[model samples]
Target: MSTAAANEADAGGHELRDLVTGLGRAFGGALVFSLPMLMTMEMWELGFAMERWRLLLLLASSLPMLMFLSHYSGFEATWGWKDDLRDVAIAYGIALLSSTILLFVLGVIGPGMRAPELVGKIVIHAIPAALGALLGRSQFGQSDEEEEEEREQSYGSELGIMAAGSLYLGLNVAPTEEMILIAFRMTDWQSLALIALSLLLMHGFVFASEFKGSEATPDTPWWSAFLRFTTVGYAIALAISCYVLWTFGRFDGLSFSTALGVLVVLGFPAAIGAAAARLIL
Candidate 1:
């Protein structure tokens, strides 16, 4: 074959392989995010008991979130809005199909179920599953070639990535009663210690430690970097925790100190997630 023809064939093969790999990643990510919720009795109950308008609102909001995720860190290396849209479609499609298959196997949905009932269950589950699909690549996709490009990122961009990571990780565990339980068990001193530990770990992961893929601006002093990233990232994490708590209606009748404690507990994971985002993405 001519050189150009060979190059074209190789390119086509790469594209096909990428598509296949993306599909697999999407499914894997969907399962990771969905399986826990699928197994939870509360999730199943919520599916049935949730108001129709609320369900519709969740569905509507999920699309934009999916798009934003795809644009930032998709299963596919998307270049533009068109590619983002395509990935969002693919992610949602995979989430819907995978949720249906798993839920059916689990007997959450079956041949005997009414259409609306079945759709509601699947849709409720698909929101998180689809988010997983979008995040799968960022969390699990490995590529040394992609990692080598050390692009200089702005503060705003870094903050955005950190916020995304915070939200993703925090959202996973925030809806459960355990978050509140864990909070209620902790005293004021413990909460302060936890906050200190979270900041220390976040700094270690992103700025101070020698972990693989850790970021360092050689010109910037370590203490300054530590101060900035630790403070900003923790703030973002706290904000995400509050939003999640509010979203799940976990804030009802809570005292100020208790709510603050809950936010700190959840913020631990969120801060680590933010640090991971800086290192990885």
Candidate 2:
């Protein structure tokens, strides 16, 4: 067999190699994604200019992260980034299209969207989903049967990671019970817990939806329908945020454009960070 296949087979035996490699990919992916989120928030909230050159520089830096994860110790990619990317492309396409239709039908979105802004939003958001799915697929390759099994095995890991990453990400914006009172208009510990609880519910909604019917076969869709629902719903929330521009529009100034670049550009890092943080850490 080819060297690639040999490594794939070997990874099954060498768990440490796979774990280490996955760790690299996941952290790399998270860094790529998180940077944009951090930058955008800082820019919008703090009134810093999101320099185009800075974005470019960040992109250039992300390639190495992708390559590193792509070439880590036990990462036996059956198909290169192309295949995972292809998966991402399909998933995001379906998501964006459906979400767009839903928005138009619901009348939740219009007026503020110029053609240019619409296209920009598409490129920005779609790229991150593509990267998230791609890196995740590459870092954690499994057949339909395997993906299902992984889903089951992933339960504990998922719960833990959600606690960390969600808390980490939310702290910057929502401020968990540990430190939320100073931020938004929320109350005490209960409110913070509820927010995290909602995301967990969202994740369960996504996983359960994917874990059903014929689609739940070994080829369980990467961008599962429920996953799409969560994303599209999130996107719609952002749209409503635009509408809220007239109301509590402070966050309208908060941006995620920076996080998008890091995330879309590097696939495995963010996914792995999430997985590792949840499971191992």
Q: Per-residue alpha-carbon lDDT of model 2 for 164-205, expressed as tens digits?
A: 333223323321122212234434454445434444545454
Clashes of each: 0, 20
- Model 1 compared with the native: what TM-score? 0.81
**Runs of candidate 2 exceeding 4 Å displacement:** 1-78, 120-144, 147-281
TM-score of 2: 0.30
lDDT of each: 0.78, 0.36
TM-score of each: 0.81, 0.30
* Residue 51 lDDT in candidate 2: 34
